[model samples]
Target: MITKEKILENISKIRVNKKITQKSIAEFLEIEQGSYSLLERGERDLTIDRLLQIAIFFKMDIVDIITYPNKGSYNKENEEDIKAILQIELKKDKKDQVMKLIFGDNSLEILNN
Candidate 1:
């Protein structure tokens, strides 16, 4: 059931949710904005190499992109990996804020201890 179209939709959703422009993504992929538009619009084929490029741009695992918000591979191991990635990308104070957003108020308190 996980068609290429579905995968494209998931990638598009991530880009939009993150407020990333198609032009920016296009530049990152070294393609024209119009071509990137076609990809997001499902008018062009999303090749494996391009998908891997996009995943790198987003600092995400391909599995993370395919499963996305539901995060099908999000077991304890993945959780730790995700936290480590976030730690590198975020400042100490910002990490707590992000953890709070994702895990509720008490989560940060527990994490800090």
Candidate 2:
């Protein structure tokens, strides 16, 4: 189950890892930084459209944004760990897409397996 809280938390990790500020995301979303902060803090309910917009801004699939690890156990710096999580969580086609997005040319062998 993809809970809103998990989605927010995953995106927050991505944002922090990428060194992107709330103000940058706020500007991208055309909303106030305070509003973005509220959303990140889970005080505000985010719409699916807004979430998709954020995913687009990050050049990531919405599933990748929302598919969090079990009990929130994950290493933000480990791409292989994230890929394994995504592989477990995603269906075949979506997994293929995510693999391509993450590893580009190197995903071929993984996708075949």
| Candidate number achieving the greatest TM-score relative to the actual structure | 1
lDDT of 1 by residue, 1-113 (tens): 68888899999999999999999999999999999999988899988899999999988888888888776655746565664343357887887787888889788568769
Query: Against the unseen true structure, what C-alpha lDDT does each candidate score?
Result: 0.86, 0.83
Q: Which 10-residue window in model 2 sums to the lowest lDDT?
A: 68-77
Q: What value of lDDT does candidate 2 attain over all alpha carbons?
A: 0.83
Compared with the true structure, model 2 gives a TM-score of 0.59
> Model 2, 19-54: lDDT tens per residue?
999999999999999999999999988899999999
**For every candidate structure, what is the RMSD over all alpha carbons to the true structure, in angstroms?**
14.4, 12.4
- Stretches off by above 4 angstroms in model 2 are 68-113
Number of the top lDDT candidate: 1
